[model samples]
Target: MPATRRPIRQLPDELISQIAAGEVVERPASVVRELVDNALDAGATQVTVRLQSGGVRLISVEDDGQGILREELPIAFRRHATSKIGNLHDLESVATMGFRGEALAAINSIADCAILSRANGFAEAFLLDGRTGELRPVARSVGTTVEVKELFYSTPARRKFLKTDATELAHCIEAVRRHALARPDVSFAIWHEGKLVEQWRRCTDLDPVIALDQRLGDVLGQEFLTQSMRVQTIASDNNLRPRIWGRVGIPDAARTRADQQFAYVNGRFVRDKVLAHAARSAYEDVLHGHRQPVYALYLAMDPARVDVNVHPTKIEVRFRDSREVHQGVRHAVEDALAKPRSAGLEVAAQLDSAPLNNGFSVEVRQPQSVPMYSAQPGIGLVSKPEYRFGMQPDMPGHKVSDVGAIWQRETAPVADPIPQEEWPLGRAVAQLQGIYILAENTQGLVVVDMHAAHERIVYERLKNQLNSITGAGAHPRTIVSQPLLIPVTFAATPDEVATAEVHSETLVTLGLVISPFSPRTLAVRAVPNSLVQGDAVSLARSVLAELGQHDASTVIERAQNELLSTMACHGAVRANRRLTLEEMNGLLRQMEETERSDQCNHGRPTWRQISIKELDALFLRGR
Candidate 1:
């Protein structure tokens, strides 16, 4: 069937605005985000958001910022009219959050909107109504107040898609929370049904880092400050490159979901894939399985290098060079988490203080004469040791046995005591069941999981050895490939086959050789030397999926880490192997020097500090 051609014409003003509204406004939260963007762009130092019925019935955003001129108040509601940018050059390097000018027009189209404002230098104030296009004199301070009533009233279909009032209110609060996190210099408050829901006060600290930390503590909670490490990385003499600064939660603080991950570019929040992928990759060596890391990373770079106008909502950005961003974020997070938390004064100070340790002294105790186990090659658990080594035999019936001497502390002169500050993990005092190493520090008891701690130390050492073998270069983590005795084939999707063929060189670096055996089948004839026993088909699938989404180095490093982790778990010192005082202390020294020694490769905590206050409470001594 043939249809007659119609002439193309410009759409009506109301229809055009409504069409733009569909993209700018998803729900009440969308309106809240856009309005807050405008308030912050106006140089607002304090912003108060009042909502009714989850902002569907009423939304009033009052900001103490430079208000609009009375003459320009009416034009502010017109589509494509904005004071943010002048032309294409301004659009190219947009520094403001709301420049598209589509938010006001789009929001006004579906809701009854009003703006009451008094310009900075003007004494008079005026109120402009969007529906009637009426302006009248009003009394107000030197600021702006924008009220949106009956959202989606004109478009009832959009209203039906919204969730319950409670869910919508939660989303609206989250939108404001994002803004508050980025700006510690500004105070924010949210009110629902005339009751205050949330508030974040402005920080007055002179140091930006301290102010940001205080803000994080207030918003994310004090536990975040205690469990996270500060991250600050600047590019070397490159002004255009990104300068990242924020905090990343320790491996032990990893959550089940990714809700706490927040990334901002030039003070504007964004959900960039490159930033998310880079942050996740940095935690691959420490966090295990489906655990998601928590971080609040703020990236500051030249505004010209990023295109924020790509999305209508301005929540997503397109970086001119995404590789630079990925590398910067990944390295920043990795460096911040490289050092163990136990070695830092920040963590030590966070421990509860008590007077219970006032009379505590370092004691060097002798080991009990218990049957000790010998190292069994390739064994990961306790082995039988029925006989003692280097035992002098008794001649016939003449026995010279003094078993008590072996368990007695030597009566030698004590050496000078070493300062506790020098040994953060402190001196090893005892070993509990050959499984835990208990030490004493200034803060109090330090309990270490011997097997888990040794596993992490061994894993780091293995990684360092691999890095040395590969050397520092573009392909620094190149894996050694091992040919398989028999090829493993699997039915592969076309996308997977395409990814395998296209990234053949990259796959080779990861020690994988996947090739097409048939139109619908792929064969993996080789794998990484360390992972030769692993399932080749599954390895190939994982590598292909990683290559499809991330760069070659990400996949290479991840695959190498998995192999090293398994090897480390197998090679670490086994449980139930009693250690001398010297051996235990040496292990503690190694742990203090090792990277990420606080947690094992499986994201389990390797060490814990039971503070003096905690001990006092446990024994009821504080009372």
Candidate 2:
């Protein structure tokens, strides 16, 4: 059976506005975000937000910026009446936050609203009421104030969807937090009921980077500042291009959730897929398991290249060239995290003679390197000889056959006095239980996880070898292969068989050879040299699935990296293995030169510093 369709007619203005309101206003937080956006677009330096009942009963935002004229007061509440854009050209390149101008009209249809403003150079102010459309003279300074009360009052169904007061209040606060993180030169304050909740003062530094760093400490926390690395880079092709700057947390600071990640394009906050995927790719090699990285990255580029009108909330954006943006962000983060943290540590005085508890303090002398007086002649306490891990005679990916032959050492004479300050890792003194290395430095004590440190060193070396063999130009490079004595067979689905046949050349470059044995089975003839001991069937299936869904070259490269990582893990030094002082110091020196040596291949810290102050507090000296 068929039913008759309703007649198409233009709805009344009130009914039309309520329908528009459904898209613009979701909860109290929605109203707060819109009002704050408008305030910021008005060039406000100081903004204040007041809330009651989690912003349902009352929400007021006051800002000191350019105000509107009295004659345009009534038309400001009309649909699509925006001062930001006039024609199609202006809409194509919008720099202001509130361009659509549907917020005021949509909000007025669902709640009680009012606007009081006084334009700069004007003598008097005016107030406009939403419900009555009444305009009268008012007393106010040269700025604007917008008040929204009884949100979703007209639509009872919408009001039922609200959460508790405390939960809603938390959402309101988070909305403000996003804006605060993007702008460091503006002051923001929030008040709930009659008490002040949160406030962020403006950073007065002349340098933008220094100001942003100060604001990050104030908003995120001092701990974040201490544990994260600063990223500032400009990526360009020909003329000026996008500039990226922010703070990325170290591998050890990764979080269990993605709530702390923020990305901005041209001073506007957005959550685009290209940015998210690029960030995740940059951290794929370092982070372990399912941990998420925390960062706040800002990108500055031409406004015409991005379109912000993709969503009603303006939180989603579209880029003309997504690949450029992806590579720029990924490389920026990678370069910032490449340098080892040990290289940045500064040497400080170990003991402060300031008295505590009115008692005398003991002065401790820094450990000095023995002047070429060790048991082995020509080898000083901390050797300056060249020590390197010897590669196999054939290829680089093979297992390190012997631990004893790993180091290639050469002795050199020491003329000048060498101190511990020159060696950041200090001199290796002893080994603990054959699993840890103990050392003394200018700062204090340093404990090294022997197995974890060696694993990272081996992993990095394997990557360099593979890169050199492949010519390191772009992806889809060839990997060296080794033939197996006997072929392995596996049951394959119809789709898997088809994928293997279609991408046969791709498989060959990755050092894999798979052929159809029957209608339902496949045979693996060869495998990568480093993954010779791995499961041939499982590796073939994983590669087939990835080639079926994602980009072939990317999937092949990732699979090759997985094989190298596995080889490095198994070839590292094992626990309960004894080593001499020379071997232990050799490992420490390698760690200092390796990039991202602070964390192992699995994102766990390989070593930690225990400053002298911590040691003093533990023993309660001078107390």
Candidate 3:
């Protein structure tokens, strides 16, 4: 007869696992940690981690640690079954990083976990069932290999929350790197999907900064790493002993994300925004809006002054001397960015893939296009933004017009190219898709998205209106306000309803009239002529998206931004569209006159650059 099974009287198994999984599994990174912890506990001197497609489908961690004893194999998944610590008081002053004993329980609860571990004296391997926490005898390698398949299997909601494969993989890679760096004495080999990714031999000397070179070298390429800026500062006081030291590649040593700006406290990886704020504070004059300087920073402080158990991920940290820490970061960033490697430091730029008006790509590099103003001597963050693209819309997330090249014929619609002496940025190379403009800047090439660029242009116009001392300036643009034959109505959230009301008049100011039709409904009676010609629906949708994220900005600011973004989208160049040199120059000149021209409406930098030295190295000239 089969043994009587105890009924799960209370909760459903799925619900139970989901709750347990929260602590055990978050993303692919979480799985990597639990697996590595198991390996380390097994006394593994060498660990190998493998991931594929961001760990969506696979995550394998192998280690040569003291493998699990045959009988204790099943106990690994039982909650609180940790070898790190035993009993209650040990939890308070936990010596090991992970001793909750929940890592395996939590992981197995969410994912299809398979574990095979064998002790040194064991004659055969152990097959452990993660689901039931059951152990049995089997034959396998002496070391341990933990495989996690179908993560978040019991929690469907969490599966949707996972980021793209690339993003998730990046996070996993970062986590693995942290572990590898932390345990330098442990030989680490990382492979993914049948291919060897990284083979790092064991290090007799483990310094946190060692991985800094390896990490940056992978992201920025070793060529740039060869010539990095090193800056250091020392300030010792009873109240504060702040020391700053790091290497920052010239402005060109940049990445798509600010991943390189690592912050560490006491040899532990931490994410401190205040430190980031300080880092940004250091790059105040050097970097433009869309760019961030790169560095690997290590901060030291008394253990009592800092706290690490603040977040589940442990990325964020609290400092005892917040001010001193901030000051230290600022010193390091400024000093490193200011030094001599400035010669080879070129900015990472987006390829000008948009079609050009000249019938061929305008291959030219411009000089530091982050404008050198006659009105103001040099660049400063607090100071007004300098014109990089000639002219820019006043705000963020708007389209820029591509007026790269214009025709001199009588049939031409706009003016001719303004001379470069007057405003060199005003010159155009080509206009693409009716929106993006390929223009030449002094330091490097500038590619302007007409819609994003124009959004900035119009945003500035509205801002000037707000700041203008001229006439009450409420004068309507006097152009016709196109009416939709059928008014468009939308269901908005409570905040969006308030957002519509606050910006109702502002919308009217921009030639769009929005009114509350119901508690959750907003009626769009009229729209800007530009929007009406295209898709007014998309323009109206912007209000809902803008309000959902944050409401700190006033309705006027939000509405106005939405309006400008819409206008830029409608008026700026489109893909495969064409324009003349005159149009391009006009666009560039406008960007020059405007402020905050580096990035488009969405905070993406409109133009980027790779220095001549970088180009030469690409061709092996500087090698």
Candidate 4:
């Protein structure tokens, strides 16, 4: 053994700091979370967070709590320094939310950090500079105030990932709010870009929720909160007993993404796909596909069973018993969503209680002539069948009518009243209950629903051309269109104009080009090829309707889809009649070749998966 010595096994300081920073700081919100947690841990009854440009430029947190001693000031900036936990044994069961003893160290490495502190009886304040870990005595201060300046200055790459100032500030406020809710005894305040964004009076009761609703008025706007539901549930197991408490908004209440589904594991906000997905699945039966619900679920479990120490920033947790947690979460969310609307504030299903003959309108005594465009007379979930375009298992299957002589029984209807333009596809043999048309064809039997057929046609056109056109414009989307001589005008608000820009190109592709003729007047011209000249204004208005009704990121595509869907609805044959063979067969052939024939333009499926063999087995004629 010739002096076996490992030659300088060491990692770079920069690399070490980067790795440490990974655990301590993830985003701007993470920075606020750690500071807030530390303030609460210090026995602070009230804390205020001020941000400059979404915490990217500056983040300052002040707390009126028992401050640190002069001698301990330098150690607070060093790594592995904390008064929250004492030993390695504490790691096994972390009682406090922030006890990794790494947040300050990691944050200081990337952002310029400063901490000013003073004890209860101490007359003077002590300052700790993270850049140098130098402690200097200052004249006068009575509490701790931490200011994080030039956040991520050492890591420009990380700063690049931050969202708009407005969005980042929103995230910062949201994080603070969630904790404020968890610790109702503590008060929280927030300021962004010098403007006071939100403030909360110290209250332990559930009333803070209403105040939060006010702060997030734009996101949890009245429209979304209007459909909210309250939830509470419990779970018990061999080694752990957990309770989940919070309110869950309906699927329609979600803003844009699943980001609205907030969950706190032991008072720490976490970002988890599994937990969010489980919460989403619980509401699938009631909401549309891919549409998430707004929820605030707090999981209080044995500290030992749930580990929040895997990362420094702690936006995720490792559940010792995920199944128990999942079950509890799913049950709570489902139960909340299932509950009927609260008394006196119910969302009416329909304006009229009864149905009228001819299926044209309701309220026969008034003698109205309006047609029932939706399944329900007015806008309601029950009337908007999610599976009307196809078979989604979310809704019932549709029957095809009329076919070739061999399938002639299905197509018995389209004998009259259809426009001359669509008559050439095939003779409508039958109109099945006014919703479907059975047409006979030489190649195969075709079954068509007038509504679904139109949707398929429009969806294919949009799907094929959308991606290519969205990025070709000067402003993220190119209008491949020409403006009209006299711009069609519509009254709208500033928010609507902003939403319109996101979908502006999609509007052009759908054959309309709009611009703000005035702050409130939007000028529209041209229309989709499928839309008649006179129908342009109402169709445009309807597109706006669908846009407002939906929480879509791609407002333009959503608006366009709405227009096409509306066209499909109007073009779809009225329900309750008979159809012929030729018309139904044509529909079947068209659906087979159409892209996404499985789902109509608005997310409804168009076909069922029942195999021909299954049809034979039903009759006891199996081979």
The best candidate by TM-score is: 2
The full ranking of all candidates by TM-score, starting with the best, is 2, 1, 4, 3
What TM-score does prediction 2 earn? 0.76
Q: Candidate 4, 100: how far from true, in Å?
A: 1.2
lDDT of 4 by residue, 327-370 (tens): 77887887766443311123322111112223332111212442
Candidates 2 and 4 compared by TM-score, better number? 2
On residues 251-314, what C-alpha lDDT tens digit does candidate 2 reach at each position?
7778999888889998888998999888878877788788888888998887777888778888
User: If scored against the real structure, what TM-score would every candidate get?
Assistant: 0.74, 0.76, 0.47, 0.51
Steric clash pairs (candidate 1): none
lDDT of all the models against the reference? 0.76, 0.73, 0.57, 0.57
Cα lDDT tens digits for candidate 1, 393-455: 222222212111111111221123234455788767788765788887778788888889977
State residue 148's C-alpha deviation in candidate 1, in Å.
Answer: 0.8
Best by lDDT: 1
- lDDT (Cα, 0-100) at 516 in candidate 2: 97
Per-residue lDDT of 552 in model 1 = 50
Flag regions of model 2 displaced more than 4 Å. Answer: 1-22, 235-241, 345-419, 469-558, 621-623
Q: Write the per-residue lDDT of candidate 3 for residues 251-352, one digit (tens) a residue.
A: 545555886676666556677888889987765533556776676666655555665545545455677678878877787776565432212232223222
